[model samples]
Target: MSATDPPPKRRASIGARRNPASQAAILAAARAVLAEQGYSGFSIDAVSRRAGAGKPTIYRWWKSRAELLIEVYAAEKGALRAATTGNLAEDLTAYTAALWDFWRDTPSGRTFRALVAEAQHDETALEALRGKFLPERLQDVRALFGAAVARGEIAAAEVEMRLALYVGFNWYYVLTDRLVDGRAAIPAAMRLVAASLRD
Candidate 1:
């Protein structure tokens, strides 16, 4: 208790000494399993095996496959990043391109497709996909357009329809494999959306 003696040095709290290398390994393994086996075949046991970590370790970090999948999707999608270049058209074009690429080019897109198929029969999976994943992307889009409203390029009242137009067009192209030229379609789509909202 002497003043000269350092007051009991505080020890790191329990579970505070997480191994970043281990965590990265688990995430990387999870992504690999997701890509190889897909959402339908994905399992904690498989991820643990692929990760060289035990079930306890995976459970400590994520309680459910859905939880882990959220992280996987976020890591892959870069969290659906949005842009605000002040020019609404350009911003929308960029956002659209990013979204398109994420859905078209990434393994996460295949995982998402599998999730969609699973959701048709699994209520819990459907809830997670609908409640968490879709809304996150939608909110990002909303923010992008909200900026347009603030700048007076788009009417505040038209934000909803504007969002629908952009989403619908993108979905149509992705689903139907029509108009593979996103470069041409993106700018044309932006102009159409702008014309609709022009005051």
Candidate 2:
């Protein structure tokens, strides 16, 4: 009440402290919309309606629909992390198998494929795909490869080249009708990939 007293502390901006519940709702609604309608019908408006959150709230967390989709994919995929077992072949086998299962079995897997399709002509979407999503995933693979090299299981010079080959092999399955039918073939694929990278 004193004149010298500062005004009561103002509440911090909503943007400063994001509610986990709001994020969960938005992401869940995003996945549901993406699943039911695919990328063609996904929008901030649709998600806001479904999540009971405002458009500004969604935008506060994500810059664009594609960025939001990336979060949904990451959430569904969970960290893209793998533990190195000090054996290159074993490590590659496990990572490859897990990656394959993700793209082959999950709804978000299909949503990712649809996003890939959408990105072919949409520049913003493609930028998000290449600049954000792919780099995030590549970093994980790079770490896995780095660990193998540290243990002297694979050569130092082959990491990037090997990563391309590994990802391209899986991408081929995403583009073809070879995913499920190709599961039986992954161990062989991993062996070949490991052998190619071995000193």
Candidate 3:
């Protein structure tokens, strides 16, 4: 309580000690487990041991494995990142590049694929994927498409269709034989998406 006492560290949540180092360690450990085991197989016990924290400490912070996975996802998934440069092509390129880069990195890439497969059977997981992971990326793309529509470079009517097409085409390559290695498909994806949105 003395003035000489060092000011407290920045607090993130409403009621928790805010030590950046601890949080980073926990998150890093969680990511390693998520990447290695996927969300379904991951557990707080393993995460605690890996994080060098106690079970109570982990439980004190995260209510459930789902909550842990949620944080793991937000921190790991770069696909949710977006750009708004006022140029549609640049915007899409930036978004897709970030996405491909994230996917190419083994940490998030393997986990994301597992998440997709998990979503196929789990309703709650599917909801989280759509509401939390999928829409964030889609929103940015929609905004870029809307900008192009405003500029008269593309029709507003085809925005949703184009986004869906882009996703479908890109995912097609990832799912089939891992052949979409950005060799001839990345720019082609950009081109196909751009053309699909054209007036």
Considering every candidate listed, which one attains the maximal lDDT? Answer: 2
Per-residue accuracy of model 1 over 1-199 as CA lDDT, tens digit each: 2337543322222253456766777788888887877777789988776666767767776756876787788788876778788887887888888777777677776566556666689887777777887777688778878887888787889888887888778766765554356557898788788664343
lDDT of each: 0.73, 0.78, 0.67
- The better-scoring model by TM-score among 1 and 3 is 1
Q: What's each prediction's clash count? A: 0, 0, 0
The C-alpha stretches of model 3 lying farther than 4 A from their native spots are: 1-25, 35-41, 52-67, 77-94, 177-183, 196-199
Q: Write the per-residue lDDT of candidate 3 for residues 123-179, one digit (tens) a residue.
A: 866777776667754666777888888877678788878888778865665555363
Predicted candidate 2 versus true structure: per-residue lDDT over 1-199, tens digit per residue: 2357554322223784688877777788898888877767888988887777888778877888989999898888884568788776677778878887788777778777778887899998899999999988777678878887887777889887888888888888787857788877777776666664333
Q: Alpha-carbon error at 120 in model 1, in Å?
A: 2.8
Query: Against the true structure, whose TM-score is highest?
Result: 2
Q: Point out where model 1 deviates above 4 Å.
A: 1-23, 56-63, 177-183, 196-199
TM value for model 2: 0.82
lDDT (Cα, 0-100) at 137 in candidate 1: 61
